[model samples]
Target: MKVLVTGGSGFIATWIRHQLLARGHTVLVMDHQDRRGGLLDGEEFFLGDVRDATAVTEAAAHADGIIHLAAVLGTQETISNPRPSAETNIIGSLNVFEAATQYRIPTVYAGVGNHFMRLQGTGCYTITKSAAEDLARMYNAYRDGGQVAIVRPVNAYGPGQSVAAPYGTSKVRKVMPAFTCRALTGTPIEVYGDGTQVSDCVYVEDVARVFVAALEHTACHGAPAQPIEVGPATSCTVLDIARLVADTAAEMTGRAPVDITHLPMRPGEVPNAVVRADTSTLDVLGADHGADSFVPLADGIRNTVRYYAEHWLPGYQLQAA
Candidate 1:
């Protein structure tokens, strides 16, 4: 099957494309940005934005399946400037859904974590994502031509995640990168609002596998995916993550143990928020999404730190030096 990955250059999308290629599936990449990630060969690339309906329709026409992942990410960034984010996340999703229906393509949606479990999320990104999820469900319920599956990934962190800029407009400030980068540079790791925010930090590889699995289920069974929910059984706080990154960096790079500084919580953040996905939901697809199957926080951190040391840290350090 030829799978069109909307956000082909993103961190998780890179892994997904590799997995698809490994499984002998043809990959079609469609993104506004050039292919900054993923394999260089064997990909039918389409340089386009998801916001354009015509672009999405043309791409979907050639795809047997679609994994919609293109969007403006980062909660705080979206909250600060919402018009563009809303346009991409909401309008972009609508275009994908419309295209799927038109072409009868089995589409997989990248949904958010358990952020909507407690309070109906209020942030611009959150609302837009939720609205998009609703569209997926609605389109599936109607079943005009195509079917859509949803994979709600929780706190995905790993290599290739961009480190946030202190001054410039960095798209996001991911914890894994921020902590690993600072620890490698022997700088104090900053935590937001006491670093007590609980998250189900799953490794990026595991999350990508989940996405691929759901897509396979939808494509093979020709049914809406079993609503896969992926997260860890144990929840790690923000401070816990910082400590893990710092400890791993110290062990791997022999960096002096860095301190964790608590900063005020950024806007659009909930300090008491917690996400523990019901991994059992994946049973419908016969995929092992059990709590123990996913990578542990400590092991994941070590891998992330090692990747940063080899792939990301040198350039950053050279710039700083």
Candidate 2:
């Protein structure tokens, strides 16, 4: 199978590319950024944006399947700049769906789990993602042969996860990388709103596996596509993750445990919510489900801490200096 992965340079997309290549499928990565450190030796690369209809269509022409992963994520970033969020998440997604429809290729969309529950705040990220989900559904409805499978992933974290490029905007860091970085540098892990908000943190590799499975699943092609929720069955509080990162970093770096500091909850931040994995979709697809077998949080955090400590910490120190 030849697969084209949009946003293939991203943290999770990189792992998905690797998994696809390992399974003997030719992988083509299409992203706006340069393909400098993202691709493996055998994979092909296409430098383009998902927002461009011509670029996306041309790239989709050469692939058997598409895994659409490109989007402007992060609550603060999307809330601060809703225009680009809508353009990329909603309009860009339409481009992918259009391309898939034109070429009659199956597409796996990367949806967010937050949209499944009641939103706590007025974040445009969720709004745009929900709109994109609807767009995928519309494509699935009218297309004769092209199918679109939506996968709503919970909080995903693991090694190789880092802050996204600035892309002419503020660099917004995800919680795991931010906490691990702070802990490694002896800075306090900042928690918002009493640190009780819960999330299901699935490992990046597991999330990648789900994407690959969805891409290869034959069931999505002939029926109305359903959104597959992917994550661990267990939920962890923000405080739990913070303490775990602190302890793991201290143990690995031989430093003191970093303190967890409380800060005012950011606008649109959920105070207390639980995200659980729904494995029914995975069961139907015959994919390895995260709900039954997810990487233990401690093991995942330990590996992530080691990765930042070894690969990212030196560069960070140099930049700080």
Measured by lDDT, the strongest candidate is 2
TM-score top scorer: 1
Clashes in model 2: which pairs?
none
Residue-level lDDT tens digits of model 1 in 215-287: 8888778655456787887877878888888888999877578998888877777777776677778677664
Number of residue pairs clashing in candidate 2, backbone atoms closer than 3 angstroms, sequence gap of 3 or more or interchain: 0
TM-score of each predicted structure versus truth: 0.93, 0.92
lDDT tens digits, residues 229-288, model 2? 887767788899999999999998888999999999887676676666676766756635
Q: Where is model 1 poorest over a 10-residue stretch in terms of lDDT?
A: 114-123
Q: Please give the TM-score that candidate 2 achieves against the real structure.
A: 0.92
Error of 2 at 133 (Å): 0.8
Which residues of candidate 2, in runs, are more than 4 Å off?
36-38, 117-121, 164-170, 219-224
